[model samples]
Target: MKTIKIIFVITFALAGLTLSCESISNPDPINAIDSTQTATIQGTAYANMDETNDTTFSTKENYERAPQGTNVKVVLNSRDFASNIEPGVDYKSLTYETTVNSSGDYSIEVPALGDPIDAEIYFDSFKTSQTQVDSTEEQRNYSPQQFPYTVRISAGLSTFNDAIYNSN
Candidate 1:
């Protein structure tokens, strides 16, 4: 009976020790903010002219028509509150805007707030000069495109490459 009691006590002690070690390793409370934490969203914005509506294109044409120096905006809206507050309250939201370089590459850094930050990316319209089949240059306008899905970001870099916008 004594031996059994000793074994039970040892098992209980081991369990307690494991729980304590786990708590020690993770001392941060839920949703604890680390001021230095940030996340980067980067991608290339492509402006393709799909006149045929077949959704097929040549690689050379796509590279030549890529949008350059266009604005890209990343927004993170606050989650809905338990009360009557609406989703995406202004006070808790964040917006980061940047312009793509000549290579159609853009990067935006946002604070890593919640456990998983949800953001939406928007591409602004731009005007460029395009050569017509007759060898004449004319100005062409491209419409803005918004990401259809919400992007989830963590503490590191999140890349959303190949953001192609079809300008028909």
Candidate 2:
């Protein structure tokens, strides 16, 4: 009779342990989906031109001209890069491109999975001129200058005012 009681107690304890483990292992489905939502990034770009021709454009006052028609590229990735280092080439990333408007403003909406997303933003500018020899022909020169930087963005609106110095 004592053996029967011992077996019953052991079976009950095992059932309870199994039930508790199953509940803890499962996660809420709604919360899991909400974590991987989207985010929007918007900002204005400026060209820090050396109006005085002195080759100094390190201050905020020098960023007076708007960088119209500049290409603004945003790359979303899982890791953040150093400020001085260029991003997107070495890692798996998603790229989004937009052109700076006439007013120098740009807006891009990108998928930002995880609580906070990592992004690399940069600008590209080109100078196009019509050649005097051929009225219908034009010359395009791509600027080698660009300012690439990284940022940590959330699931809402994030703003960044970027200024790239004019290397002309």
Candidate 3:
């Protein structure tokens, strides 16, 4: 009789343990997709305006007169240069007219949805014969301005993981 009671108690305990180990049904998924994300990427394009004898202008004047290129291209892709750019999506130019402070630095505004798109600003100098005087050398040069930087979107799992891994 004692053996029978012992066996019953042992079986009851095992059943309880097994029931407790079973995971409860959750209405929500363990990893819900996060829709809301916000991030910004900003950097300065460092380039002084073309200063030539034909355009006898101060640094500030030269910067101000410098034709700000309208075609500052922003190329964004989901993969890391693995595939070609996505189609049907239009990329807006991030070029704006702003004065370079006494320290030759220009701020270009690049508005974005959540995070600024990965991009580089190429400042293509527009030369004109009217602006060109007797200086032939000045007319032949094209000052291309380029700035490379990364704009991170808001904190995602991948970003956090990267940060933690990098810190370690």
lDDT of 2 by residue, 8-113 (tens): 9999999999987884455223222243466777776655333443345454554444447688888875333222334443545668898888876788877665
lDDT of 1 by residue, 41-112 (tens): 887766644333333465435434356667777777643211244445344655678888878788777767
Stretches of candidate 1 off by over 4 Å are 1-33, 49-61, 65-68, 80-92, 145-149
Off by over 4 Å in 3: 1-65, 80-118, 128-137, 145-168
Q: List TM-scores for all candidates, in order.
A: 0.58, 0.51, 0.29
Model 2 regions lying over 4 Å from their true place: 1-36, 50-61, 78-91, 128-146
Candidate-wise lDDT, in order: 0.64, 0.60, 0.37
**After superposition on all CA atoms, how large is the RMSD of candidate 3?**
17.1
Shift in Å, residue 118, candidate 2: 1.4
Q: What would the TM-score be for candidate 1 when compared with the true structure? A: 0.58
Please list all clashing residue pairs in model 3, or write none if there are none: none
How close to the true structure is residue 64 of candidate 3, measured as C-alpha lDDT?
A: 32
**Candidate 1: RMSD over Cα atoms?**
15.4
